[model samples]
Target: MSRTPSFEPYEGPAGGWGSARSLGNILRREGVPASGTLVLGRQNKVDGFQCVSCAWVKPAKPLPFEFCENGAKATAWEITSHRCEPAFFAKHTVSELLGWDDYHLEQVGRLTHPMRYDAASDKYVPVSWGKAVREIGQTLRALPDRRNVVFYSSGRTSNEASYLYGLFARLYGNNNLPDSSNMCHETTSVALPPAIGVPVGTVALDDFAKTDCILFFGQNPGSNSPRMLHPMQEAAERGVPIIAYNPLRERGLERFTNPQSPTEMLTHHETKLASQYHQVKAGGDLAALTGICLAVLEMEDHAKQARLPPVLDHDFIDTHTHGFGDFLGWLRTQGWAELERRSGLSRSAMTATAEVYARSKATIGIYGMGLTQHRAGVETVQMLVNLLLMRGNIGRDGAGICPVRGHSNVQGQRTVGITEKPELVPMDRLAKQYGFEPPRETGLNTVEACEKILAREVPAFIMLGGNFVRAIPDRGQMEPAWREIGLTVNIATKLNRSQLVPGRISYILPVLGRIEQDVQNGPQSTSMEDSTGCIHGSRGVRKPASPHLISETRLVCEIAEATLESNPLTPWKDWASDYRLIRKSIGETYPEIFFDYDQRMWEPGGFQRPLPARHREWKTENGKANFITPKGLAEDKDMPEPDEDALRLITLRSNDQFNTTVYGYTDRFRGIRGTRDVVLMNRSDIARLGLSEGDRIGLRTASKRDDVRRELGGLTVVPYDIPAGCIGAYYPEANVLLPIWHYAEGSKTPAAKSVPVHVYRGPAAA
Candidate 1:
């Protein structure tokens, strides 16, 4: 609301002057350290700290500036010299700071001390790490049940820290390990294991270069994972057909001018990324994918009729997969007209897209949260896997499924046993190695954890990192739920809204950033698993903002040492002293995946964690890939058919934003500037609703749920190229409109992608 937003066409492709401008803005705000020169070229390559933002993989070799625009911003942000010490907190009270926007709160600068809130003065003051740990431990000990406490890990945390946190939680008799993964990729974890063997993606970065065809399903790489754009650009240059399916035509998926290319950087030459674009309506991915599959099936049937070679990989299907015949029968039940009706694409378009997949010997499918953050997000993911399996895309060079995960180590956190439910976490091995019986029962996820907190079942809420409040839906209740928590401990690099919405007893634990020297276990580096499963070492080159800062691993161990004093076998101090011991413990527990963990990280190219699914092996109940067939592609069963005046609201991230971290108000790709409270609606829809471009509107959730009165007022509507009946708004701000109970039933991921809303008048048109 600072400036009335202005709209213009974003003419240039992604990674042009716009990105450079964004990067400059970050550097100017967060005074870059002297060690930036050392970090610039080495960030994502071998022996460098992974970008703390997205989980995009690193190249084998290094780039002069190895990071993308946002990655560079994140790097500078973490390495800034600005400090938010006791004096800063003394000036700004929790209530006063809560009124400030997310960007300003973060811009206030890095948290440089472990400060506990003194309710008497309504201020946070410096506290010793020992005292902080003791207070947290005492609170944990005092809990009526260990389930009353929750341990939430962010994707930004290191594998060592997450592993130790998981261990500590189980040892403390609480397996309530809610994490950032539950918010973003829980669908992948739930859907993939049944469809394929692994919950994580199977593709490596090299697969992009070797594949002849790739399908970008509901992914905006330029904004979320800019590094992935390079591979897509290269794949396009090779004449490989790159098809994109999304409700919004994201510039990242449309075209990319690689800033890494000196030629393109100077000449302004651009590479068109998507060969063919399919603009499906919101929550129509399952339908779109089903249409493509239907077309493929039709092609196979035609091939048989014409006495030609089989179009489908019958051999692979017969050998490695199960339930194909049943899948085919289910496909027969669904008609092309229905699929096309729901998908918002023509039959010819779907057929042409299917043809590309049928002809290509090696093809890869890359998807993101757009497909996953739905009512049937897990099924949507499984549908993508089904399409790939039809052609035997798994376990082959240049062909696999790639879930372009957001956050640096979101996938890594899960791999290192951060999930509430047991995956590859060897409980027997942990019991033998650490002399404790780890709980095998399912624990809380991001949504479940919040629900428990709201119900007053959870007393202490602990987050390793991330702005949980802004990121989660149902903030109408969630905000209050966070307030009700008895104890809240947040280990963070910068100030976020979640810190302000604290419990009765809250502490802000400032910790070392990825660019800060973490000399706890010697001058060592932390490792993160990229989206493609490449584990690489990250060593911070800059000095800490404050000497009082602690490492997340050390912090977790200290709390565990204090809390689990009765457990003699848990060597918290020993693990804290040397991070290698923690990794050794991890390797011992998860030998098949994290084998030779310490030595593997030191090796060149680090290591590619093995994917058993890549070998065409399934870990399903029957030990074979299962084709799950939903009755129809439509996701929201509870969603009522919108009135002609109603709109399907899909939450989005601007080019300047990642998750809840807002860099600027401008969304250059959408051609909007100087405001965050804006909506993108179809031109036809704007006309139908009698709302002209730039008209202010308020959104009311059109749900049957009586208790949910979520609304966001004063949003400027900007008519764009989106499909009719669907509208777009920025996330966290729009998260208010999404109900608490409205989430993916299978995975419990907030269905931020689709929320039926009634648009009403707000203020007057400018």
Candidate 2:
């Protein structure tokens, strides 16, 4: 291939990279030879630090070489030999660094000093730990109300850190802990609890081993979570039908060449995944899932009329569910035409999928952004729960609603009560455990937090770990919103857009990465939950990047103590001086599952948390899963009407990427190289527009802006394997196309995956 791609001088947002191959390509471009020593001590290990890439499920029985292509890159990115120490920062001012691309900044390597943005010279000057803490605390205190401050947590934060961070926020009299979840799976959180009592995934790792079939929707496991490909490969081998519902024909969904399969590798063979692949359009999952559920219910009726056993699990449904009659009535109202049209699938395809689902002894329906970024996002998830409930799939082995997460510890962060609205039970328990009155009032979510900052209603912001500005939609609004804050503190390991956007005073506190040593008051290990619901312990074999770098647990405790007037005990203070106390706090607050967390983490593989649904129990308010009837199909009014020159533009990830952090520019699977400017267009639509491959174009949103004429124009176009009426662009860049008001109903997550816009031949007039 063209000499492996490397980092270039990208002049876009901070903390962003587009392609995976860029790293190698950039290094080669810079004439930096690949460090052979850097590749050592990274392979052939189980029970090592987990991949910090996408939230893919890992192997329960750790394989000798279990990592995927993305996983290896994620690890290398974190543990690279390159270092951006204090000397490096001194060479360039914040403004000069800002001129560099996201890829260039990260490729320079790890941040070795705590730096604060000095606005005078527009440079990042080193600051003492004492000054950093006091600055942040003073800003929080200066806020009109504690509610003015927001604590945004990334999925990369350890469970111990998340717990301490939430406790600090609550003790400080606010619950505005808008996490990454609000952007990805808030639909599951808001809708699932109402329908099934649990807002998270109901299936466990063991459930995958037991289930007869796996039904995947709106999720691309290959790029999102390559680790899941293994379990899928296993299920496929066991004769379990693995069905995929997606708009694009994903290679990850097709046959996979297992890097760990020695036999297959030698023979140059591969295993086929996704026995059945259905190409559903954007926002078509609800119709597809609804059709399948309705067909299953109809087949049951036919079987009963024929004096055969009902296709539905009537016994399980009778005992553990409500609203069956209403669901049946609603099913009758949705005709085959609506199902076929909405789902972009033929009626026969729907019938065939329903047949496979009915024949299976148990099934698990897994989904992600595809379903969550729609106007009917919440209802779509509820319907999936209903589908599982009808088959008694949930509370049974291997069958239930599994909302896959994007970040590694994102779900666990929520589980530890990192939320805008903390549950009463968890809050009361936290107060009792920490000797402080936790906040009862609901706080601001992501969208609301940005609004507060924009309105000058918020004075300060502290992010645990995440590229908040780039990650959040409406970058136009978000960039200016940061300036309104009196102080902004980001507890991060590296520099990103969040670091560059300054308040009156801004501090970027360097912290330890997950793969680094986490030394506390005493010897202890931290644990996290994999996307597939497996809890595992993580211990770093490598030393901390710097002795100056502290664990997130220590940093949060210090800040909480500095900012709080209530004399809240520094939970991580004593714990940092030992990690066992942190584990004890986790066990105390969530004893049911985290019981003996300290001891359990030490156990070889770590212990699994109890998923009641795995045993066929519904935790809904009614003590049963209720089948929800969706209101009706809704369209993206943002798109120009059918006759208008509008095509839906959805954002996607390259194999080398994980969320906003791009490892490289080239997409190996898509055959695109050396560019993030390429847009994946439907072949037919591009042909109709008289556009060819590699054509430079501008993409304008159908919904014009009233305040500013902002549009995601001037992008390169490339025909990809995607459906008609659909186009694809990378996030944060495409984020400009997503208006602040354009969000999923109820969940408030921007429809980053599905946007409608018009394509032009060249850049719009600037």
Candidate 3:
């Protein structure tokens, strides 16, 4: 357990000495001090493994130390000297390990061998790979309906492995493939295709160089993607205006001092990032964005009256888009007073931001989960698209919609057919090439899968690389439901909370990490797609943590081989032994996208998958970009106005964490030390709630449903510079308060950002 946390204001910039010191401390703690630098030196290089962190775009020209603090921690965490062997499990039972925190569980180090749960002893025992695969195959084969099985993939998986995993699920007769994207950027994938003709971001790494302005929304680059700060700093230094709109003023958007810069490091000089920062209310992004567009239209109308040049891009709208007149008509109907009340921003600020967008020749719109993890996630993204469409930002150099994805290959996983919706991929081609009937019926997504599991409908669950139990919402209900499932299989490198909450029959299959060499056929390489739509090869340099570990591809192929009847056309053995064969098959599957896959992936910066949106070609039903209008300003149309006692909860990650993996107890950027169980509230809200800083508070979900009681207690209150009526808490801990049924309407992403809750003094409060 961690010590009690202490709060203080962070006075320094985002990076520089603080980041460097943090990295050094993590290395020393992981017992890789000297060798860690050597490992990090190879990260993100052409001939090296990709960083297993955020899917930030890698530059065409590389730097010597391209890895950031989070990347280094991920690498060190994977390459740690400590090991979780069979002997360790012999001493501690699953129930005992369940009491350990997430950080301590992962800190126990990498799993050395495949293990099977012995329910009698409540402990895991080492199992032979052959026996484990055979038994798992028997269980899967015994299932009455293939749709009852769920195959979940993580963003850390490579494209090749993800493709095989998807193919295996389909061949076994279902498309129930729910990946990490379902929880994060599914909104972007579902919303962008209709507007931009692509599911991924349109901008490349080089776009930042030519962009004259940047519109940043809801993403904190300092903790989530540190490497993004380097380019942001460069753009800041080049006089490019960066407009940031978020509920909290993140340190990364405020100012930054690049740790790689010697002069700045020595002088302690900081570069201001966001020229203008607007702290919009949580769940108010739709209203805020609508206000900006309305302000832009007002500016255009005023320009016409003054006989000045038109503010709208008439040529682009006339030539390549539809529904403009309707959009214009709706903008005129919106009232400014309502917009201000909902958005928590004054009209002058909206108009000023509109002026910035109208004056700049090119502007890139960037956003993250803050806009996605809401009830109006899809609409919010479409509104961002609406803003870009007005200015002809799509399909233009240095200007486009960029969704900063979380996991490294999340976008890549979708690209490789890891989706619950079969129509998203070329199912006919896959059926023809592999000689198997593909499942045409839509499959369950992450939330839907959980619903089925809770209903006792799911028979088996196979996880590729994530802590599913911990990552999902409504954990109090899900954990017990997860244990009730017939079988659960986890393929991972380290021990996580998901593994401890085992099913009736469970197996923990240890796999090689990204930094470990896979020697299936003399050494193998895997490909991953970055957030910018670039496909590159990653070859692991270090040896496996244990000789007992196997490659993810091999493990997936072996399971497929054991479960399904042998097919001459599939040739699972060939693909398992040589990844090039898998690439060749993928090339055949997506000839237009992955042509000459093996050879091109080895190029200096690899190659970019073609994005039709980048070339002014819309793949919509009418072959033109369409303007989408959201129904209302409130993200959740059904959400009743909160009472005076209610506050909107926004779940966020700390600097010492990535997704659900906790590295330590310190949130360096927020000046939170030694604890993760705390709530950041506006000073006014704190006072209004009759609470002071350091007061222990309890929060209960303000849900209409009466069946479940979701509450978190003993949380220390820390006054923060956030908007009133909004409070922030760390995710996974706060995920319990998010109702499982409350999610985005179209995308089905859990509405974690705008959960309504009531706060009060805890029993321990003085």
Task: Give candidate 3 misplaced runs (Cα > 4 Å).
Answer: 763-766
Q: Which candidate is the best by TM-score?
A: 3
| lDDT score for residue 320 of model 2 | 76
lDDT of 1 by residue, 303-409 (tens): 99999999899889988888898889988778888887777888898898999999999999999988989998888888888899899999889999999889898
The lDDT values for all models are 0.84, 0.74, 0.91
Tens digit of per-residue lDDT, candidate 3, span 297-318: 9989999999999999999999
The list of candidate 1 runs beyond 4 A from truth reads: 33-37, 763-766
Candidate 1 clash pair list:
none
Residue clash pairs of candidate 3: none
Per-model TM-score on C-alpha atoms: 0.97, 0.92, 0.99
**Would you list the rank order by TM-score, best first?**
3, 1, 2
Q: Residue 199 in model 3: shift from native, Å?
A: 0.7
The model with the greatest lDDT is: 3
- Find the 10 residues in a row with the least total lDDT in model 2: 11-20
Residue range 1-766, candidate 2, lDDT tens digits: 1234322222221111222233345434433325412332332233456556666565545666556556656666676667767777678787677666667667777777888877887777888999888877776766666666788899888888888888788877888899898888888888887687766787766778888988888887767877677778888888889888888877777767665566755565667778899988777788888888888878988998999988888897788778988888988889989888777788888788899999998898899898898767888888888887787787766777788888888877777778897663487777777677777787888888877876877777888988888787777676776776787888887777778778888888888887776766444467677765666677775677687888888888888877877444554468667766777878888889888776665454446667665565667677777878878755554444433377777778876578877777656666665767667878798888899876889877667434444476667777777878788887757777777767778888777766767777776531
Candidate 1: worst 10 consecutive residues by lDDT? Answer: 33-42
lDDT of 1 at 366: 91
